[model samples]
Target: MNGVSKVSPGVGTGLSKPVAAALSIVDCDFHPFVPLQEVIARMPARARRSVQVSSYAAVLGREHNRFLIPTGEPLRLDAVPTRGGLAGSDPAFAVADYLDRWGIAAAVMMPIQAMGVIAWAAEEVVNSYLAAMNDLFLEMWHAEDPRFKMLISVSPHDPDAAVREIERLADKPGVVGFQIPMGEIGLGSSAMFKVYAAAAHFGLPLVLHPNSVDCSLQNSPSCAGRVTRSYAEHHVLLSQPGQGAATQLVMSGALERFPTMRVVLAEFGFSWVGPMMWRMDTAWQRGGGADGLLPRPPSEYLLNQLRFTTQPYDEPGNPRDLVPILDSMQAHRTLVFSSDYPHWDTDRPDVVLRRLPVELRERVAKQTAMETFGTRLGL
Candidate 1:
């Protein structure tokens, strides 16, 4: 495979030509992922086989025959082109191409496959695979560009290993923080304390990404559900588990325990902020909840420790409404812009900005992301 070169602008490389040559933007959510097989290959031999067996079992156990066949595939391993095959299917989705085309200064890349799914396997298997995947991402993608940073994926099923992994990778260049799925292993469970503690100690954020666990829903009988239903369930489940976890962390004294830990609710959307904050505040003001459980209202803890990413935004809603909503939620500094690139429903800054006033656009696009990630525009 040929070494991939950064696609330069104005060379007609199939990217949308930038409207402003001087515009500097940083995309908080971009995904430039490696193949699963590549991640598998990087593991130790025993760990590699274990992952394969688990993956095979999961696929074969499924009722669908889709797992058995060798679907037609390609062997090329370079960054899949921004133009033909699976790569070019969406003209606007290429990360490198989009960065250059849109005049983005940098982007923080997240993994495509949710690492939490691997936690369904045995603990050792999941931990080893998670470590391998993180190491591979650090060595392969993030190392290639100083501007491209990554969120290290962690499996909370084994909190000890999760802590060790965080300690090992905390200082590694290009690793900005850790990514945890919303409903994986119940955030309120005692099992996750060590992981949260480790993140706090390292001064790295724990990003709660949106995903569905088999046992997350309260009364859902079987994990088997239609794909569309599951997708919808995943989105709705996001804030519920996150809120539950945040509440637990406060009530259980995780925040009192750590004091400096930060959490980011990525891609859970921002509409719920208003109501969630109101309810928490109301409960606290009335002294309706346990007094010794937390130092203040749950919303107060979240304001200090939590942040959220905005994507799949509702453009039809009044933009001015977001300002006060965030302020009331104490999330003004917590809201960051995200593109959710490569997904079907992604936000286009150029088009989204045209709808908003110039001041709002600058805050959401650049200032918010910079504050959240603790980095400045490379440009």
Candidate 2:
């Protein structure tokens, strides 16, 4: 709040130019950051001292994005106002820059720090800091506009705490989903079932935004033992964890246990869904679909339970080629639009997949998102 000035209409006047040709849109993976300072400010005194006087929550400020060329944090520099402030640190600017400019009907808040906090903090520290950030999100952004729905971030480190967080804020008009931090943990592991159950109980989806965290799960962030050299390689392989998580969740019996559970693979490209689903379906059938577990093939569980964001939608040499890819994933049923706004590589809704058939395009641009998050517009 100290450095983030409210946008003066004339200065930061007018909303951003619309990306896609559409007027009404629902952006699923928007990042709303509470400055690290603000998060520290909200912490209980001991935590506050821990953050300021010592190296507490240091990972939040780490250079996790620079495994490639020295390009800094993924945020767009322009997003940091000419007036001086951290990029994405101001909600008023986001209104002027993303929502108002594009005539966006609704945008989900996936706070970056909210996810990062869980990756490194101790369970107790994670709980207090997360709760504070949730409250901060309500006061700073969600309370400002109903269209900016909040996704409360929960650490898998504490299942009971995660459930409590869900129950505590589920009834809020702006709270719509939960950010399930990407870690060594898989979606189906018994450790995560409680979090999943709690989310299903509230009808809120769990968002798994991939991170370069400590996970021995799949092909490590790098094929060998190192971080890849460029963002291009890392970006291309971003869907691995989503694929792995889906496999684990299905095999672990989490989906069969909580049938209504919904999962959103945030920023995880949609292109992989077709191949992954096919692979799982084939495996499930060969393995008898269930050794006393899953009643349906893995693909059925994935198709019905999971949704993917089209931020880095497949871009073949010809954009039209991406259509077949979307079709394979059942575009209308499984895809949702996510700009990943304010990031340096943020997608422009109008430009990303401007070549799809008119009807199919609209579903990706808005309708699917409406179905995914629509229940909250009135509340």
Candidate 3:
């Protein structure tokens, strides 16, 4: 709010010439940040006071992204606003820097800190901070630019509060879906059923964001049962939690209970999905309908309810080798393009387009995202 300019008309105005051909692309995983002080200022006095005493770093979790990169944060140096503000802190600048640059039709704003707070902060603090952050983005970003979409940030710790938050903002313009932080709590746990039900009622899907904190935190159970020692280690195994979440959703019969519910595993690699599906289907058949919970083979549930983002795209010795795996997973229907914008490892839309086979490019880039989100994206 301090240094960011108010958004104006004519997105892509910053570019010397418009790249009209790329305008149909939808970026499913773009990160936007609000200054912590701004979120603090919007909070109730009680929550403001409580958060003041808590260690901000501990409350937000130790962000390895900042230290892992040379720029003191995971952001690309070029993504920082030319007007002098942190990367992703300014919505108007992000429009010019990312959305405009790539001709992205809409870029979903995935606020990592907001998602992290849901996992790390006190219940009251988490609720209060999330409410304030939601309002901040609604007014500061969404209201200003419709091209910048958002996900409702909710905590799995308090299902009632999470439901209330979902109901409060589900109708807001540019709010596409719900994002829950990944931690010890598995997505398919009974405690999460209420949140899942609420999302389905509103036609909003749930998004799971895997993080380094979930893998290393002492109290939170790691998917691997051991803490990661380095950024690379954490990054490599990042998809494990996503795999676990997807497994739970299918095996626990969450999708069966809520037929309309959908889940998006964002920023988690898609390569593992093909093998995981095979393992799940085999286990489901051998275990007699997953102990009477699942009604069909696990892959059936996954194919109908789960979707994945393609970023940090899997590259092998031969790029052509990826075709069969992509086909096995029905990637054209399940995979969506994500730029992971502003991060050091961000992918360019054109680059991702080239990596994908010509037949799958259109759907992966835009169609799947539109189908996954439907009218919620206001596409």
Q: lDDT of all predictions, in order shown?
A: 0.60, 0.71, 0.78
Stronger candidate by lDDT (2 vs 3):
3
Score every model by TM-score: 0.77, 0.87, 0.89
**Candidate 1: stretches off by over 4 Å:** 1-15, 20-23, 53-95, 114-119, 214-239, 249-252, 288-291, 317-327, 354-357, 375-379
* Model 3 CA lDDT for position 275: 91
Model 3 agreement with the true structure over 1-379: per-residue lDDT tens digits: 7878855444344434545346478888888877777788888888788764223342255443222323445777767776676677788888776776677888888877675563355788879898888888788888778988889998757888999999999998888998877774667788888888899999998877765334533235355746665567667877888788888888888998998988888888898898999998888778743457877788888988899998878879899999999988999888999988878878878877888889898898888888888988877
The C-alpha RMSD of each candidate to the native structure, in angstroms, is 6.8, 5.5, 5.5
Q: Per-residue lDDT of 1-379 in model 1, one digit per residue for the tens?
A: 4777666643235545687335567677776555567667876788777653333331111212121222232112222464443431222335345666676766777764544343354677677777877887777666666566778777656678778888889888777778864444666566887887788777777776543333232123223342224344644444555566556665566766666777767676666776876776677677645445666777667677777667756554566765556566554466666776645456766775554445566766677666655642334
Return the top candidate by lDDT. Answer: 3
Least accurate 10 contiguous residues by lDDT in model 1 = 58-67
* lDDT score for candidate 2 against the true structure: 0.71
- The CA lDDT at 170 in model 3 is 95
Please give the lDDT score at residue 154 for candidate 2. 80
Q: After superposition, how far is residue 232 of candidate 2 from its true place, in Å?
A: 2.9
Query: What's the number of clashes in each of the models?
Result: 0, 3, 0
On a 0 to 100 scale, what is the lDDT of residue 141 in model 3? 80
**124 in model 1: Cα distance from truth in Å?**
1.2
Q: For model 1, what is the error of residue 63's alpha carbon versus the real structure, in angstroms, after optimal superposition?
A: 11
* Per-residue lDDT of candidate 2, residues 197-247 (tens digit): 888888887777765342212223433335655767667667776777777
